[model samples]
Target: MVRRVVVVGIVLAVVLTPLMGWAQSKAVLPPIMPLRDIKPGMRGIGRTVIQGQKIEEFDIEIMGILQGGGDVIPVRHLILFRASGPVTDRSGGTAAGMSGSPLFINGKLIGALSAGYLWQPGKRELALGTPIEDMLTVLDLPNGTAQTPWPRTFAASEPFHIGRRAITRVVVTDTLAQAQRVDEAGLPGMTAFIPATFPVMVSGLSPRAMGFLRQALGAAQPLLQYDQEGATFVASPITGGSSVGILQVRGDVSYGGMCTVTLRVGDRLLICGHPWDQMGEVEYALTTSDIVTVVRTLQEPFKEGNLGDLIGKIDQDRGPAIRGVIGRMPRMLAVRVAVTDLDAGTRIEKGVQVVRRRDLAKTFAAAMALTAVDRARGQILGGGTASVKITLRAKGLPRVISRENVFYNSRDVALASLLDLPDALNFLLYNDLAPLDPVDMNIEISVTGKRQTAAIAETTVERREVAPGERLRVHMTLRPFQEQTVPSRVIEISIPRDFPRGPAVLVVGSAGRQVSLESAPEQGLAQLLQQEPQPSPAATLDGAIQLFEDYGKNTDILLQLIPFGLPPEGSEFVKFDVFAGEVVRTDWVVQGEIQIPILIR
Candidate 1:
């Protein structure tokens, strides 16, 4: 009886599997119009939200098709659309946030509302459309390549082209998101045509912090305004013509664009009528968003919205559009931050859910950590002593990359103490090898009211010369920060047994790396990050350990004894011009430089 009942239950479960209910989620792929079939003087209408979730239609007439593009993209085809009717009167012309709005002619689909001219002396009616054929090609494309075929191009006289492409700023840790800019030329005649890379609504960042973000990111990353409405960000669904975000950040700082969802086939979705970053075959986080309202400006109009839960991965970032997949969360690097305030006797611990991206992983993570520390302390860190311990773990590494550094600055110790981790991550992310397989990261920061900086007041040496294998002692006087206490220490070392019978120099100075200076090459730093050669994403974690070790610490006290002359003919010192001590790394900001001459016999 039990065997018969169990088999009957199994059969019932199998039979009911196909009957499970999924709420009505329609994929509106009306109908497609091929570029070859489109001609001038054709009439149509399109749908998009000028404000809120209300879908409205505007009249459109095809002026003609364009026939010229660039070198890499040989496809010379884009449909020109002229606007009229009530939609034209309300919006004046094409909007920056209306890139992927679908157009229908004769009750069928044509393509997305992509771009428009930057300068407009009168009514806005001219715009460009990326053929439905190309936008559809984004559905199932591969890395570094697109499947869109070169359609036949027709000759059209003086057809208005899309605006110049300007890089968009994107970050997904806690604070900001920015889309692309079409007005790259910045001509004097144009009012302010920011018709690309829709607004990146940011939350939780003050104006000052937003300014700091600009400083930290520099020019390669675009800047966007701060939005407070995204504080209640949650996830929804990815459907056709719905607002979607290629989320880079969540939590307190919502940084990602409010873009239009172009198409959906099965579990696959297409979005961002233009490229988000155009880093093909990417695995970026995708989430649903709700349009709040459109802020109209003389320069440009934008849509501000709140991002919803992360539910998918953006599989491709190509020219025509960004494509994504639902039902799977993207792989992310885990970040944990602990801030201890001694004065208040309070400790705050926070965890950041950072997206795992090649160009964004390190910078975004570091910004998140910095924001966490700043928030825990109730303000930006300034004029205080801080001890930071950073632990880095990866998949294949035998041990964690542990770094402990101290900071002493009159302005802000926050940046100095926590800089190494970010720089190291940057090196790892931008390595010529593979992506870094980061397991988890912990940054333990302790703060105190006392200042921890001193300058070398005086230096005294035991002797001007020394014999081989002799021990030498050096005394130094130090001046503390605005305080009466003057503390000093003695550093000692022994001359090499086979030292050359010649003069030498002893150089003593501040130890750790320079905080104001950039540790990376300037030329490459200004440009966009290129794709790395990777066997697997985590291929270079081990070598990155060496890079982290070499960047030096800010709180370190660096001391060195250099033999000024060439070593006696056969000594190992011949390979080097100077003998730097084994302890070259430090966390202390160097305050003084002193050179003393000595003789080695």
Candidate 2:
């Protein structure tokens, strides 16, 4: 009899298997349901809030369905009719923080607990819920296939317990039934639900700004590339005015943030114009976190749509055509190369050159030295030539003193003739440019000596042919002083017949001291004159006289000479006499002097 019973049971199970499979396949699952069906007297499951985790389920039911609708989508609301037990601890009825808890009815998804509207005082109101259907629609997942199904092995009872009461056995069928019943009554007001989480995208910003953000995020590599155009050759002004040449920007690597610059010619590059923003001149690096790249052609101006995307790799080399890169990796850099118009007769090409930052004044000094030599040669040769001199004064580098090949006629020389000149020898002496690189020196131009403070000055020298044994004489005059008696002096210098035509000093002396001299082909007479003494502020009469004498001894009086050439047959003599006035007061005195000289060779 037992064997017969077992056979019959097995046969029955086999017959029902196909039917059960068909039923399971045909059953379509509803995505969501309303919350109103949960009657105050009904029994259902609720979601228990967990810290740092998704909310779990609890036993609950709808008390009453709130009905309202407007132009917006209707929100089917349900009240947590009742709880099987204490729904929460100190947190308060799932507490004020328990909003967004996904509630389930029977075995199906129902709605999320929103908030409570107290109809009266004393009696606490139940929690209201927004239907899952409305939320899913707003999330653009109305079909409910956006995510995978919850694990069946996970205990639903754990989420739906009433204080130690594990009520995880709530079925989806019951949850949906309760929500559907609430919906039948009336939908709540038209209020769209905000999704718990979502993703978004944005664009459009300045390249500098974007590069800055990338650096802030601690990107490892450079996001943009920068290219350098070779130094541009600028012609000296010809229309009686100075013409500035193009200030070429060199290729350099920088991270996101402000970059500070000290321009060789700041005035020529407008801060607000193309290359830079409208920030005043500064020396330190400015903060710029955006990616900024050079674009060589219009077809490739932008690598990435946004600046923030590119930060590292800004210094990578692109084709010769592109000038900069501005963006993050994997994104192509937009190339931009702006060709500025060169002055009428100027041309530019690539060569070994250095960008001078602070040593320009030194360079100018070296150039001036060269110029003096050229002037001396010109005087002897009877004509001037175009020349260029460069001096590198910076320390740690070898002394660089270069003089361009002399151009006999300025008309035949092109501006390019001056390109690639070396730096000034004393250019590096100054650590930095003061007020714009102040240079203090006892400058001696031939026989004249003066203590001067200047920014920078350049000199060039050129040589021309002079008849053999012919003497070179230069005429020089002092620029008269408007306020003070010019502390100036001069000396005659003669070069030997075989001495190379380059920078050569004729004479050197201090103020007021007379240098008795004779003539020689290599050594010239140095005539140093003391200037007229001005009044002095001294306490006693004797002190005043002494002061005047001291001043006279220190002050220089310059002598102007004309028609520099070989000496003519005649007498050459220069004389000066001092005159003293009676002391007007015990502390003051007036003194003067006059110089009378005769020149003969």
Highest TM-score model number: 1
Q: Estimate each model's TM-score.
A: 0.75, 0.20
Candidate 1 steric clashes: 25
lDDT of candidate 2 vs native? Answer: 0.24
Query: What would the per-residue lDDT of candidate 2 be over residues 407-478, giving only the tens digit for each residue?
Result: 222121111112222211222232222111222211122211111211101111122223223443333223
Best model number under lDDT: 1
Query: For residues 69-136, what per-residue lDDT tens digits would candidate 1 score against the true structure?
Result: 44554645566778778865676566556677777788777877766544455555666666778777
Instruction: Give candidate 2's TM-score.
Output: 0.20
Error of 1 at 228 (Å): 3.6
